[model samples]
Target: MSGETPLPATDPRSSPTRRISIVHVRSGVHILPREMLGTSTFGVAMKLLKWLPTQVVDRFLLIMAKMMIGDTEKYGLKRPKVGPLELKNTTGKTPVLDVGALSLIRDERIKIVSEVESLTSDGARFVDGGEMAFHAVVFATGYKSNVPLWLKDAGGVLTAEGKPEEHPFPNGEKGIYFVGFSGKGLLGASVDAIKTALDVSARWTRLSETKDVVGL
Candidate 1:
């Protein structure tokens, strides 16, 4: 938690009333509840992306992004050069919830920059040929699955990148079940957990019967 800044009382994330209103509820038509995105309905929609035309999906996402932001010029920002898909593919598919992030950027309370090129004594050089002094540098590198690192026998279960070799949810290989690789986030993970539990239960019951038969 180094270099953590104090949240202002005005920030929505810090406000008790705002927090209560937003939590577990859809605040408006424009804003869908975060929980709904993890539901089965949303999972089906995401799955449909595999079959939908890339151009159509990209256009839809771009329109949605524009609708969410409305006018970028009002916030002292220019339109983004890249579409949502490119950003998602490059940075991964996690949606950033803006509690006070937009306000911070608009007020210049924090700085967003390009990829770092190298580290210097004072600060860091960026890919965009910019450098600035900093009190601290925190790496916001994306998450990586650690399954491949620790799991000894990951032959059929996981790939080199630690992703499930099998497509979609319920990915398993040789009795080894994987959760959270479906890319549907929490809902997919929950589904995997249930499936794994049922499978394991059945196997355990059969094993118990075999032991009883052998009188062991």
Candidate 2:
């Protein structure tokens, strides 16, 4: 946000026709269009990546990012520093692409603030001792799992942060099982649900047979 990129003032992309300004505050992020992810080419690349070495796959993603997002440096922004896979590994979720986000960001009507010192009813104060007044502020920061707060005991299978510790998808402990903990999204959740239902049904049938044999 602090760096200067010599863009022509006449550039229509950054036109200052509107008085409303949007301030984007964040650490570095990785951005890719949702449509790109759905492409057949991308899907094929993913399948091929599984057979390649990690180093090669990472370099391949780096090249793919440049091809998709263009040269971020040319805009005087150093964001999208982490690739998609790296971001997913660190955060446990993939980035959601907002349509036209890139264009909105590069507009002259928008400002980027990387650090904030404080916030008040009036506006936000930056770490650099600068302040700006705003009519409203919206926080788009993601959510955290609240499982730790309500789950009584997890038998060392879950972390204090409400995430599974034993495996990416938690192994069933006692009678408790977890679904949608794999960070693979809804499709992963659906698969987990089906597996859980089948396992529970099998256990129930065995219990019923045991009770019948005992005449209870």
Candidate 3:
């Protein structure tokens, strides 16, 4: 690995320290052009400078990147002489959060897999005549949003839990709003906003008529 590369320096095999097992990496890890973030964009700009507070800049940068979410083709870094990186990094951990999903592993050094040999179901298959390994494989899967106890007052209202007894809405079916996760799209905030508004309006309309409605 290149010494100047942003990735934490540690051999995934065994750094004596927890180099492969734990490391602080950027949340969104993808191969990018060395010049991808040139003082022009928030995401790339913050990365360029080491003196700035990431919290103040990460959100804006994230939003900006969201605009180009799947534009990976445009940002594709040509496979080096080493051929394709075959990085499934999106399924791995970032440098900041280097812990396992269910408290599995806790290494503060750097994230890495134990060995490339373990990344397969086909037994020992080192086709490249090279041994690849990692100490930590950050499974960066998404969250499952299920409102376990969300309940509606309109006879049967659906909530976070898909039930009518759990009141997850801040306003309890009236002033409550969930502005995200309505679809598999990226606009989580927008989705939550739209749904919350619809819920509020429907509930109010029901109240105005003094008639109980069944909402499922």
Candidate 4:
């Protein structure tokens, strides 16, 4: 909203032309070391776990977590009882494929707060009586698949929980399609996009052929 004119919702052509800017927000001041964040440890662990049995993968991940984070109790962090791969599979959360950035735990510039209490007329007010002024603030919280209010009458394309009823595409719309809904992470999403593109191209060809046949 700050950088460019908003696209008209009714025009599908404008969807591809729109651009998004991401602003990352963290609530903690204690940043992790650059070495921990940027290391290939997690990536290598994931790759090794891919072909292993689930039980073996779980054990391997638990070992890796101990090696990577070391003594969590000393750092005041509570490690989950379940392994990372198991937790991700059960929760349907995206897998972390890379760790290439410094965490807020080790970053000195960040001032951690308990929680943001409210938005004052000037800026954000923390629950601990701290306040900061800024021109813009963006929340990097996770996503929910809420259907736009304007699309209420479009039939049952989305489920009651707002997830797409169909994988790779939703129902009740001819041209409407979705990519990266597989929850398979970035590389998987790229492959999904390629397959979706091929499918759409074939559908368009069929539609064009039908028009030609009707004319003939």
Candidate 5:
């Protein structure tokens, strides 16, 4: 989260390239109920409600949204066109509370920067007319599944569309398995990891026994 850069020998004020600037650009959308941020609460709620019909879940979410976030228009936020359950199911993501720009606006420590124009050999130049000399850059990005590409046959563990199959770690392959691959979110993923580990251990034990018997 932090980095150090060597300063130029000359005074920074006298040299144009001696200063460093850090810029962070992002989509301003923020979802809230700040207490729920960075927790698996939303995913657990979704799992518990999964048994209910989609319509029922949707209606429930709509009510909850109203109670949690009132008057979206007043806050310059738009009401979701679809239900939370629908969105979660479609995106394979559990809903998490987000309060977009509100957090940044309230925090005095964060200085928002304008769009980046380009990166020079020494540092980054902002479109608004300033440049910074940075020795390191930290980027926070989301994750993507690369398991399919790693498997001998991608379809062995994934569906035709690249989604994890119901039984993410399927049988019929020797010495090949998966762990921590679940569409059910973190809680489900942990359960899947444990179960898969147990299964794999048992399978290996049986294989070793069979090999000993064959040698006998």
Candidate 6:
């Protein structure tokens, strides 16, 4: 199993700039006991939490924040944060927020990165003295975003196959605007996008009013 062990954090389908298979262990997991969702382990905890119906995770987060070594609120954020759409820790294990950053816990097996090398789906090749595989390989590197999904603009059509719709998104028509493409956090992105849209709409409305005045 050592040789076939799953490669670390790099998503094979995500990157092509520099192919690397590093040994990565997950960095984040929440295992507070009072959690009702019971995300006691890892892996699926984050995913399952997304579908849960309570603020248990958030509560634990706040509690954990208080217990941490530094400025508690700054670790996650500082606000009177209360939201109905909550992630659940339905899994028996403590739900991990960022699976890519998940940490090792006693309950969960620590997955380490190993065999950081080029992926060679292609035929093996011989170097000056040794053999190397993979003429070219692709990797899937995960991304980070602070925003939630619903907040982000639907943008293109969401297809059944999860393929993005075929519409010129945020195209500058009579009224269209985009806030963030390479922005940070999923939630932030949505807020920014919406702000743009609103601003665009307001400008359009004002221009229309002026046009009506001239026509009158």
- Highest-lDDT candidate: 2
- lDDT tens digits, residue span 118-153, model 5: 766866667789876555555544466665666555
User: What is the C-alpha lDDT profile of model 6 across 75-140, one tens digit per residue?
Assistant: 322223342123221311222233322222222232233233334454222222332333342333
Estimated TM-score per prediction?
0.53, 0.66, 0.31, 0.50, 0.48, 0.34
Better of 1 and 3 by TM-score: 1
Off by over 4 Å in 3: 1-117, 120-129, 143-179, 183-186, 211-216
| lDDT tens digits, residue span 1-216, model 2 | 211221111222333665544444355544444444557433644675679754466566556666876755444345555655555545554544536646656764445553666775666677778766665555655678998888776668678778777653334567778888777566467778987888788888999999999996
lDDT of each: 0.49, 0.58, 0.36, 0.47, 0.51, 0.38
Error of 6 at 98 (Å): 5.7
What C-alpha lDDT does candidate 6 achieve relative to the native structure? 0.38
Candidate 6 least-lDDT 10 residues: 84-93
Candidate 2 Cα misplacement greater than 4 A, ranges: 1-21, 37-46, 53-58, 73-82, 96-98, 148-159, 164-170, 184-191, 194-198, 201-216
Candidate 1's displacement at residue 190, Å, is 2.1
Evaluation by TM-score, superior candidate among 1 and 5: 1
Each candidate's root-mean-square deviation in Å? 9.6, 6.7, 13.1, 11.8, 8.6, 14.8
Error of 3 at 109 (Å): 13
The global Cα lDDT (0 to 1) of model 1 is: 0.49
Best by TM-score: 2
Superior candidate under lDDT, 3 versus 5? 5
lDDT tens readout by residue for model 4, 9-74: 121222355422222223111111123335554455457667886558667655555566444334
Residue 182 of candidate 6: its Cα lDDT? 24
lDDT per residue, candidate 1, 1-216, as tens digits?
Answer: 001211111223333543211111111112111222345323433665788854465556545545654553354333334443443444334333345645555554433444456767866666679765554545533467887888887576678898878554443457677776766456557877998888778878989999999996
